[model samples]
Target: MDTAREFLENITAADQGDRVSRLRFAPHKPHAEPSFYEYSVLRGVRVESVRCGSTLYCSFTVPARLIDRNGKLSAGAIASLVDEIGAAAIHKCGKPMDVSVDMSIAYISDAKMNDELEITSRCLGQRGSYHSTGVLIRNRTTGEIVAQGRHSLFSLPATASKL
Candidate 1:
């Protein structure tokens, strides 16, 4: 595990142009520039992994701070999770693009505090102007389908240099 940690640290630290390109698909600084969902420590949410290709997949975990009065993860928090995942996917594109134009989330189950979650996204074919992707939120603890949704991201010409 220490080796893996060093490997990842090296991967992020190396100056290879292409390697930088790969990492550039993610936020400029993920831990430093978190999305809105990161505003409160209410829930523990972290970007677990990322994959970029025809589509993208990114995973986020909810800690437990932002649960509702009912003691479950808040819907707004979940929605933010989806947004962050989609935003991450866009960043992985390695080019500037418009933000999400359309999306629909369906809550399948509820998650409690301290329950780790994994969010998955897949490219679901695309139309001319819009690239579509499907997202899934699952509870790692119980393997419950917590939520599912589809998101449409609009791509535009890069406005500024990604570097």
Candidate 2:
């Protein structure tokens, strides 16, 4: 029995990987720029366009750094994209960003390193301080959907946000 191979195969990738995790085997860097998690998950994203203060488009290439042992994009990376891009859709410049209240993601397929992607986010609407947005992530070359997400947000009252 190859116990070493079995051991290596048994390590499932986590949202926060084991090596650089603050809560796991590593100590705080105190000055890691953008931090490892953000760099791995979000660093290379390119903003394509924004419209009406409610729609956003972006482009990304799945980087190897965010891939798991099986060569698939990590679920956490997809979730982070949905959360950050979804919030950007409804955000008006010069306004404090709304807080994420809920998020639901449907992961559709595997995306590998260097796969080009198109990410689109649109504001669904708002009722008072509550708002909803949807984000779609798809393969730019093959037109296959990789994930869909819906996010809900809540705006803080002006009085409560005063500095």
Candidate 3:
């Protein structure tokens, strides 16, 4: 089996532009059932790039369902987006899949419904079994920052059976 790092490197070695475009068009498989979170919170989100290394980028068009009573994107939805993207970046950086130790988000500005958002996440660093990642969400058209988030994750140890 390929190591996580190797798998990500192979993906990055392919045609990057094509890969990004493909993700842009089809964020999820048509035949697969959406996960509960995806169905509820990420219906209109797209994966812009899943590049190897410590960084990844995604996009979403804010839909009515994700809007708050104040006519802006809901805080909970933004937090969920940040958490998901941060985990993706950590995975690409070769961190073993594990639960989040902590996550924090700071809402900088408001994005109204129908606004397009660009989310960029970067794995800051890792120490032993802990990984840290940062994410920034911005308005796609105006380049205004909407929110910023940080995540700390605990890496799982490889099972003896796998070894």
Best by lDDT: 2
TM-score of every candidate relative to the true structure: 0.62, 0.75, 0.71
Winner of 1 and 3 under lDDT: 3
Whichever of 1 and 2 has more TM-score, that candidate is: 2
lDDT of each residue in 1-163, candidate 1, tens digit only = 3443354457644465655455322344544554333445323445555555644444445554467989888888777677656555545444554568888999989988777777776667656556777778898878899988888887664365486
* Span of ten consecutive residues with least summed lDDT in model 3: 1-10
TM-score ranking, high to low: 2, 3, 1
The sequence of per-residue lDDT tens digits that candidate 2 reaches over residues 24-123 is 2234353343444555467889999988758999999998767988999999899999988998888766676788999999999989999999999999
Per-candidate count of clashing residue pairs (backbone under 3 Å): 8, 0, 0
> Tens-digit lDDT track for model 3 on 11-84?
66457566545432235553365544656676677888877677888898998868888999999999988877
Clash pairs of candidate 2? none
C-alpha lDDT (0 to 100) for residue 139 of candidate 1? 86
TM-score of 2: 0.75
Tell me which of candidates 1 and 2 scores higher on lDDT. 2
Candidate closer to the true structure by lDDT (higher is better), 2 or 3: 2
Error of 2 at 31 (Å): 17
